[model samples]
Target: MPRKRPGRVRTKNTNRREALKLSTMAPEDYNVRPGEVKSIACPNCRTWRRIMGETVLKIREHCISDKVADGEKHVTCPGSNQVVIIDIDVSHWQARQNRLLRDAMPQENRRAARQFYKPLPAPAAPVARIHAGVTLETARRAYLAHVEECVRCGTGQHCTRGGALAHRYVLVRKEELARRKAHKQSAPAARKALWDQRGGATVETANNQCRPRLDGAVSEYRGPQVPSKPLRVIA
Candidate 1:
């Protein structure tokens, strides 16, 4: 007969009774660390015990039911180490772990932390050219600035581009003057229309009636005089 090779002996029996209990088990009851041994609330002992090995599948093989001291007799847990089939939500577990890790970080550390980012390419230099359909105000400002800077841009005379820009500026000023004149002419009629809409005549009559009554009250009423009795102090 060949000599029996020495090896680690298995402890704790994964009997049928313990395996049946896992059917009603929830994910919360088990503490899972990815790439590490998983621990669960022992159904038999009602204490946290580690499931055997890094691989969670094939869990029916064995489990560490309870912690044993040197020379102490191992108490076998009623929970089954055998009778396989365990479901693990890997994504949910990873998300939960990440949340916990974030929460554990210090406020200062977390605040300083930045996501990985590639620096944006620098913006291209703006094109140097006159803008199309420039507004009157913009043209006026540019014309004034150009005349102040350039010696050639005098009262009537201007550079080639300046001549075209100056014409646009003059046109804008003329249009603005026309608009202001039209608005001034229409303003009194607009105000009268708004006043009529609000029944201004009735409001004015109410105000006139209130003013006379208020004047009469003001004329009759004298402000309160100082109290006559001044020597009344209780002991």
Candidate 2:
């Protein structure tokens, strides 16, 4: 077999040396200065770029599969094709560092990265039970009425108390009104039925009275009446 190329052997030696150097390096050896935007080469595309502070820290804290926790300046390229864990303290000087890094980046890239991390507003307190015995229906109606009234007055939008009161009133009144109306309607129908039955019975009794007396009408009529007028001869 032909002798192994000297160049290939040398390249292999160089790679092995570099790997040894990296393995021997401690986490503290890569301390990043505050306000410095460290550029890292992408392992996949070999492109160089910088990352955000929050992203860098988060990755540094949780990216490693090994059990050893190395608090360092960790960063991954935007494409996530490469990750670097460096020993650095950039947390306290993040703002200044990010500003410089942002300035170095293209205007479009900088704008894309610029975002506000606004916290979401807290939820509102639940509506309190202002009035007892208020049914849901009544409460809902009251709430609607209050809204309507507010719209008319132009001051209702700001009236928290008014809305609550309205809801309560609607709930109670609606139930009561419904009950009263139902009673009124049903009561009349019942009374009318009773009156009709009574009238029917009275009419039946009157008809019975006109019939031949029960005690005297045992036999059929068998009588001839005397002539009131002389008979006319019309042969």
Candidate 3:
């Protein structure tokens, strides 16, 4: 009626139908609102979109209540249909801003607050002590200096090399002495009979057989030597 202008013009009825179609579409089909969150469990994608209309309304309300700057954007929840208008205190917000500004600067340029940083103290020194008297040191040295020498070599080094030979000779001599003593203690008739059977070869062979066998069982199980009593000092 007012003068139809523009190409592909729609009649009044057609324009009304188009508007109705748009209105019938769900609010979610368009945009999201601040504070109002919507959750969808769709097979294709699971995501929430804010409704701009609702967001703008809630933001306006929050700005009035909190007296926040008009330039700040409102925050939105991404879960179910719920909205929350945040009204942060100006002073608290400023402190938070200051912290962020400080954090943005280089570490070397930042001021060190002693309240946040403390130096560790140095460790204490250790105690010392001294010992007196002749002690064990003096005693040990005197003992070594006056120790007995080897009888065979007449040297300070004890004779360990000729030990086996000396042991065998002592054993043989002891056995001979025992046999002679037994013969002397025997009755007159028994002694005469033993003397009648004695031979040089038999006596020598018997003495050799009586000596300990180096490879025998008794030698293998020999116990450690028992130490003799310490010699008394003449002084």
Q: Which candidate ranks first by lDDT, i.e. highest?
A: 1
Whose lDDT is higher: candidate 1's or candidate 2's?
A: 1
TM-score of each: 0.32, 0.21, 0.16
Give the whole-model CA lDDT for all candidates, comma-separated: 0.60, 0.48, 0.38
The local lDDT score (0 to 100) that residue 229 gets in candidate 2 is 71
Model 1 lDDT vs. the true structure? 0.60
On residues 154-178, what C-alpha lDDT tens digit does candidate 3 reach at each position? 4544344334333334555566678
Model 3 residue runs over 4 Å out of place are 1-152, 156-158, 187-235
Candidate 2 lDDT over residue span 1-235, tens digit each? 5532211111111111111121233423333454454444333334443432332221111222222356554442233422344443456445555666778888766554468889999886545345666676767666666667675435645376565566566667877899989999999899879878879678768878756555643334543354447989999
Higher-lDDT candidate of 2 and 3: 2
Give me the displacement of residue 15 in model 2, in angstroms: 99
lDDT of 1 by residue, 1-235 (tens): 5543322225444464434234367655666555545567665556665556333222323234334555556655446464334555667766876787789988877864467888999886422134455666787888787778767786557976667667768877787789899999999999999999999899889878744564433334553354436878899
**Model 1 regions more than 4 Å off:** 1-137, 148-156, 210-235
Worst-scoring 10-residue span by lDDT in model 3: 56-65
Q: Model 3 residue 25 lDDT?
A: 33
Rank list by TM-score:
1, 2, 3
